[model samples]
Target: MRLIPLLALWLCLTCQSALAAPVRVLNIIVGEWPPFVAEQSKQHGPVAHLIRDLFKEAGYEVKFHFAPWGRVYSLAANSQLYDATAVWMYKPEREQDFLFSEAVLQEQFVFFSLKARKLQAERLEQIIGMRLGGDIAYSYGPELDKMVADGKVTQQKVTDVKQNFGKLLRDRIDLYPQELRVGLAELQSQLDPASAALITHSQTPFLRNDSFVMFPRKMPDSAKLRDQFNQQLQQAIASGRYQRYFERLARGEY
Candidate 1:
């Protein structure tokens, strides 16, 4: 009788503690794309760093978690395993299952090809007849994915962005779509200066436009938290800390 009563008391106390505490990002999760977000075990990415500081300044403590891109998102959207994630464009289909904070940073992805292939392709429509290399089921948009599923162009989906670079270098595919910031970083790390320069050519400037990061929308108090996040994000950018963080990470200091 005594042991039973004690066990019940402990359970009640545990539940009460959980219910009473404000959620300070009980969990953070990200996908496996380095420079953006990638880790074999830990969860540190350029976008992740922005989120870390944003919540920290808002008086919330957070912990980081790791999972593959698809699994991390599905777990958050389904099981509530994490409170937030960073750097994805907003999607209406996922709106009910997740919350979106304001855009903290902007990024763009564009098509790349060897200089010679320029004569054949100039825009998304022109790629219809050419083979395209991408990060495999990579999201450009809902309509873009539909195009792939409908077999408008041949897609060579690779495991990582590096593989896409290789295919581009070898002329295995005529075009590859990649984020400009990330692509430049990877080329610097993987190839000699001259070799890297000759590897691929983007369409002079970025063709596809997309904004990224500082979004988290799956916590218990997602709405309240997202609002708080946006305020801090605006202030962070105004105060210069945000720009510094981006610069440091782009330079690989973080």
Candidate 2:
């Protein structure tokens, strides 16, 4: 009967709709590293925007959860609450617990000092006796860490970048090492023009390194997700979209 045919068509459509797969969502954890990743910035900063777009191309949506750096790293590594964490510099020891994506961002760290001091150091050893302001939770690099451990350099530890810069301005610390862009962004946001102008970084880089997104090794699909992300990232780079994000960042669009 005509009624039967119409019901059959309706059932077929219903089955097809029900069978369609839902878009997957990736819950990613991140910390405050502005101009790269920050909770308050548009699309959570440039690197985060790039990551979202790459995942969108791969048919996944990203939900970012921001926390303190130490908590962010610890939660992502030990718990299933997050699918991954972003923008971590490579450390061989971290390989045991997480799988790293292809290099996401290249960071150049330099020493910021009072313009009056005009501190310039080609090597960590060059600034050995000077008091270095540092984030207690963050690692500068292996060489700098070793120097601090061996008591080759005097380091004054603080809880955050803002504090280090504050100490720098107060003449409490001789030098503070931070990523070039991140340091500039922090100065612009945290200090008035006069105060910010007093701080300048060295021309020579203290450290140049690449950062990456990391997935917990315990996750069953971590490798697969990382591989998919890498593929999308490479394609974006080839299509010139990846570079465009950074261009926008330079223009303060993010």
Candidate 3:
């Protein structure tokens, strides 16, 4: 009698395990926007971790690929070549392509200048005539765009922050216009200290705060995934579960 009961319990456990559902995630394309998504380690950043957990809870598999931000945007827009990407700044034109959940975090814009250039600018006008380095297709706001259009600030479009930081170290450009936290992490992850140290954020933001995310357009699970993410995100924020990771970021945990 004892053996019969034990056998039944074992079978029940096996059945429950077998009944667990599996999630099928499509390929996602993203860029190495550190503290958000670091390409080197798929599991490295906060956003990446949040994305993995949220979708997993919702019973979906996830796959992420890293490249230049322009390509990531293109993939999300077209939807044929790739399935999703992370940390996209909200653009009105892109609203059609991506099914975005509520933002996971807000990013701040920052500028890195060569001290010798005397490139001090309290406002947009001060950056006139200096070469501003950035990834192609990124938004710099109305003031910066106006400067670029008027030829007040010479714009240099590069493939990634790694290369641009090299240029900054070499004094090839005046400033690397970027977000403070993201820039620091990208620099630290992709470049050696010798090269990364050359750039310094001036803390003068062209755009102070912007929201971003993991976005999917082509997938049938688009709406479902967004809802799942939002639900999990709310829980994470409420519990202060995510702040521990940022503390690691401060301690160079990435």
Candidate 4:
């Protein structure tokens, strides 16, 4: 009868509508960098929250997988394990493999040494022959990287920031480079109170850099996803949501 045909048409339309629903899910690899993206922080920290909010506004679902920086970077760059990885500084080699988003956060690289060492360096040249502690695969901007590469500065690699702090306290290294606040936080949490108190960071920052999220080139529709995320991120900044969120984060208001 006419009702049978109409019902069949209606069911077909409903199925088509369901199939057409736009729900794009992205798996983003992230490393544990506190106050930026951490498993224990509220909403997994501000940068993580910003990424989630921006994509969600554009009708996308974001799932974050936390891992070591090396593992996260490798998986995101070489495999289909992740659609994106976050909080990396802009690097030319990385640009070849992934598309970088606008900077979501800014931080300064500072030198940390024991209070008794009397260590001070106004320039990279001044630090020549000094042992610098840093992560093996990480980039500390062009100047520092060049210093390490050219043998102007002796570099020691550690698995974590806390290890660097430990090495510095034990006088195994001359100086450790780290973000000021992040280094202080790690010191307070990972070191005994006396050792943390004996450590001090330089007043002069070695490098000021911005952090960004990266979308892998291998992901299907990566360009489209980047465009969508960039659009939403701009809207967020224009509407003052971005600034407000960052301010709240700075105040530890979560």
Candidate 5:
């Protein structure tokens, strides 16, 4: 009968709806690192935009929480407050607690200084005894860490970029190490043109580090999710899907 056919179709539709898989939403923590990750920008800046796109491509939902760098790392690493962190520099210590995705980006670590200071240096040892500005929580790689730990070099701690730039300009610190692109973005946006013009980074890089999305080990789904993301990331990189994000970056659209 016509009524039987209608009921059959209704049952089929209900079964399909009931059998559909639920969307997976991954919570991620992010810190302020401009031209890459920032709270104010649409898509949370280009790097983050790419990250969001990558996960979307993998059929996962993403929720981003922006906080101070130190707090973000603490929450992501300790309390399992998030399933992952947007990006972080890889270190052996992190490996024990995190399943890092394939390299998402590379950061050229360099020193920023007042142009008048003439603080150009190709080597960390070359600038020993001078006060270097650094964030307490950041890693400048193992070699620089050892140098600081052994007291071979001195570092003055500042909480954020504004303070770093202020101290460098006042001679409170001679040089500050920051990712080149991050420093450039901060200089242009946070400081007046004249002030920004006075600051320049070292001609030589102190280190180059690959950044990655860090999945906390405690998450029950961490390994599986990481594997899924890894596969998609590899494909994105290989097929040039990821490069489109940078193209948007070049156009200031991101």
Candidate 6:
């Protein structure tokens, strides 16, 4: 009778321990946007580190899956494999497919051009007839998008940033607009010192937009996860921890 009681107690303890284990894992999909989210950078870049820390505070472990930008958006929207996608700028069309979290980062978009060309544009209209290079499926905000749609500016679309940069270098495209830090990181990583120096960006920013983490609408717990993430992010911001991540990013720590 004593042995039977002890065995029952042991089973009960084991069950309790199993139930208490922390097994919440978030499968997040992302793309290669250096100095923010990159497979090769430290802690997978600052944004990744920020996201991981925030989720950690919420009692979740984040597992990042990197793919092409197009595929990242498509998979996160249509497939059940990924819980969310990170660091996307807001667009009305995107809201249809995913629930967006509070703004993660604010990005400044500017036009990159060859210094030799002496290109100076205070506004999009100033460069009305120039050939612009752009990444496929990217939104350059409503103003520029309308300009392109109205044929005020000619845009040549490519698969990735490298291709657009290459086109700009080769004079195939006169300008390429991209996030400031991201464009600089790409130049540093892709071009030689002299070659990189030849490229420069306009002083005026074309768009200043906030980017967010998007949870797929199809996921049952998407709203809950987004709410939890937003709460953690707000707390971090209030405590000044959120700004520290960007400080580290500025110092090239990430």
State which candidate has the highest lDDT.
Answer: 6
Tens digits of per-residue lDDT for model 5 on 33-107?
888888888799888888888888889888899887878777887887688897889888888889999988888
Candidate 1, residue 94: how far the Cα is off, in Å: 1.9
- Estimated TM-score per prediction? 0.75, 0.95, 0.82, 0.90, 0.95, 0.94
Residue lDDT tens for model 6, 155-251: 9898788888889989999999999999999999988888899999988898999999999999999999999999999999999999999899898
lDDT of 3 by residue, 122-203 (tens): 5676777888788887877666877888888888888877778878878878878887887877776778876665556765
Question: How many clashes show up per model?
Answer: 0, 0, 2, 0, 0, 0
Worst 10 residues of 2 by lDDT: 117-126
RMSD of 2: 1.4
Q: Least accurate stretch of 10 residues (summed lDDT) in model 4?
A: 117-126
The whole-model lDDT of each prediction reads: 0.68, 0.90, 0.73, 0.86, 0.86, 0.92
Give the Å shift of residue 74 in candidate 3: 1.9
Order the candidate numbers by TM-score, best to worst. Answer: 2, 5, 6, 4, 3, 1
Per-residue lDDT tens digits of candidate 2, residues 35-126?
88988899999999999989998999999999888688789988888889998988889999899999999999999999998676767778
List where candidate 3 sits over 4 angstroms from the true fold: 1-20, 81-83, 186-198
**Candidate 4 CA-lDDT value:** 0.86
**Candidates 2 and 3 compared by TM-score, better number:** 2
Models sorted by lDDT, best on top: 6, 2, 4, 5, 3, 1
How much is 223 displaced in model 5, in angstroms? 0.8
Write model 1 residue lDDT over 148-219, tens digit each, in one string. 778997888877777888888888988877777777767876667876777555554434444443233545
Model 4 lDDT at residue 96: 88
| lDDT assessment of candidate 6 | 0.92
lDDT of 2 at 128: 85
Clashing residue pairs, candidate 3? 110-178, 129-152
Candidate 4 local lDDT, 1-254, one digit each (tens): 89999999999999999889788688999987876788888899888999999999989899999988778888998888788899899989898889988887889889998899898775677788999999756889999999889988988997789889889988999999988877876886688898899999888898999988899988877788788889998998899999887798779865
